[model samples]
Every structure is written in structure tokens, then in C-alpha cells.
Target: MRIKAYGLVEFTKSGYVKTQAVVLTLTVVLLIFALLWQPTGMWAANPVFGFLEWWVLLVLIAEVAETAIMLLKFKEKEAALR
Candidate 1:
């Protein structure tokens, strides 16, 4: 497979951008769902199903890391262009 040799390609990749956006959107949706879950059914007895409430933590962390990396990459490229 041929790969583009253009610098900073991943920064503008559509697939990667879509994946990131989906992750971020799902994170918000799940957080809202977790807030509405009553935990009165199988969720009451099963820890696995209940774990969805805690998924926001992972999502938050992932978003933070993604943001940091993007910022760092931007600055790196900025310095290179100087």
C-alpha cells in the first residue's frame, strides 16, 4: 500500500477524526444514560452492567490525553515552521 509522505497527515485524517468524534459523542451519551439508570433490575445485582456508570472516567481521561497530544503536536509543528 502506498502512503502519503506529506508531513502531519494524521492530524487531518478523516477516519481518525471521525473515530475521535464518535468516542467523544458516545462519552456524553453514556454519561447521560448513566445518570438515568436506576440500578433496580439486573443492574442492581450485576457489577458488569453497572460498570457503564464508571465508563465516563475512562472517557474523560482518554479525551484529556487526546487533547494533550494534539496540542503538543501542534506546538511541535509550529516550532518546525518557525
Candidate 2:
């Protein structure tokens, strides 16, 4: 695989691209719902919704960490190639 400066090659190879896309879509949908419907109260009052929100956040955080790791590895590989 060709190593690019941005390190996207490794990120895509690790298969987190699809997961990040889905989580990002879900986050955007949830944000729109919360904004248009003003469902902040419901999010807090409903256990299920609250849990959903937290779950999304947790998944997002995990994805971020995975991406960071992949980027770091890519950087190391690029450095070694130099």
C-alpha cells in the first residue's frame, strides 16, 4: 500500500471508515432531531434515549482513538520509509 502523508490508507485498511460514517450520520440525525424538536428534556427524562446518546458518544470516542492510532502508525511507517 502506498503511504500518503495524511495516513488515510491505513485508516481505510483498518475498516473504521464505514463505522465512522455510520456513527457520524447517526450523530447528525440526533443533532437535527434535538434541534428541531427541542427534545433535550426527553433525552434526559427517557432512559432509553439517554442511553442512546451516551452510546453514540462512546462509539464516537472509540472511533477517534482508533483513527489516532492508525495515523500514528502510518506516520511511523512513513518515517521508517524515509
- Global lDDT of each model? 0.65, 0.60
Clash statistics: count for each candidate: 0, 0
TM-score of candidate 2 relative to the true fold: 0.49
Q: What C-alpha lDDT does candidate 2 achieve relative to the native structure?
A: 0.60
lDDT of 1 by residue, 1-82 (tens): 1112234445444454566688778888888888787587666888755776677767767796875676566567667769
Off by over 4 Å in 2: 2-50
Candidate 1 residues lying further than 4 Å off, grouped into runs, are 1-9, 13-22
What's the TM-score of each model vs. the native?
0.60, 0.49
Residue 73, model 1: Cα distance from true site in angstroms? 1.3
Candidate number of the best TM-score: 1
Candidate 2 lDDT for residue 74? 57
